[model samples]
Target: MAKQFERIEPAHREMMGRQAIFFVGSSAGDSRVNISPRSTTHFHVLGDLSVAYLDLTGSGSETAAHAKAGGRATVMFCTFDSAPQILRLYGRPRIDFRGSEAYAAFLAEHYPNGEPVGARQVVTIDLDLVQTSCGFAVPLFEHVGERPVLDRWAEAKGEEGLVAYRREKNTVSIDGLPTGLDEA
Candidate 1:
């Protein structure tokens, strides 16, 4: 059986806290669906109906562009270790681009611990519905560690190199959508 709610309760927070990875969902009207498997830094529950995830510079900026276009997003979490529940958060997302006041504040709050690495934006989801279902079909997998390659590679690139990489690799959705490229 599946359970649904209006917002994230305390129990959902526990499930969120223990997970290593989750899938982010977004799309523009009639465009390709963007489902990203995110795993670098974990998300933090802002309140009963809010959640924030750091968006590191990845291959594509579809999630940011899609969310910015009109704030549509769905983030899904699955218990891959102990329990067997699938959690989906459907909401409108607010994106804080890098160097913005919001991003700076978040960094200050989580800082020294949340140092500014290759972060590009922060997507905060305002929950509209919370859905939980029996994840009987999901295969359980152990979380070994977060691969350091992204950070290492990003560092090696330096500032200019990262910008070039984003311009080359992260500026477009696979379906030829225009990604909001930073002019830096």
Candidate 2:
């Protein structure tokens, strides 16, 4: 049976900390839904009811666009190695662009390890509910390590290059929704 909580408990937060990857699901009204796999050591629990992740530059900006359009998002973290379990955080998200005071403060507070390069925005989720379920069908696999391709690509792009790239590729969603990247 699945369990639901109003806020994330300590055990739930611990499970999130151990995960190497997570999925983000979002959609705009009357538009196609999007579910994308995100990888990075960039996820953080801000409090019992708040969580945030640094979103690196990517080809699609659906999540940010949908969230900006007042759509809810679901973030899922699954255990691939130890016991079989899955955790989901459902909430509304706000995107803070790089160079904003909010973004800088968020980086300083949660990502003390240092923010990742190519980080275009910080997606902060204000939790409405938390759920945990048995991951009976989620196959077990070992986490080797984060792939370096993204970091390498970002470094090669350089700061100005990344800004231009975002303007070119990350300004709109597949379904023609504005991602607010123009303001970034």
Among the numbered candidates, top lDDT falls to: 2
What TM-score, over all chains together, does every model reach?
Answer: 0.91, 0.95
TM-score of 1: 0.91
Report the C-alpha lDDT of model 1 over 1-184, residue by residue, as the tens digit: 8899998999998888889999999997777788889883647788899998888888888887786567489999999888799999999887787768888898787665755568777889898999999999999899998888888988998888877887888766777766566632
Once model 1 is optimally superposed onto the true structure by TM-score, how far is the C-alpha of residue 162 displaced, in angstroms? 1.4
**Which segments of model 1 are wrong by more than 4 Å?**
none
- TM-score, predicted candidate 2 vs. hidden true structure: 0.95
Q: Put down candidate 2 lDDT per residue, 60-165, tens digits, no spaces.
A: 8888899878888999999999999999999998899888899999889877887778888999999999999999999989888878898899999999999889
Which pairs clash in the backbone of model 1?
none
lDDT of 1: 0.82
- Model 2, CA-based lDDT: 0.89
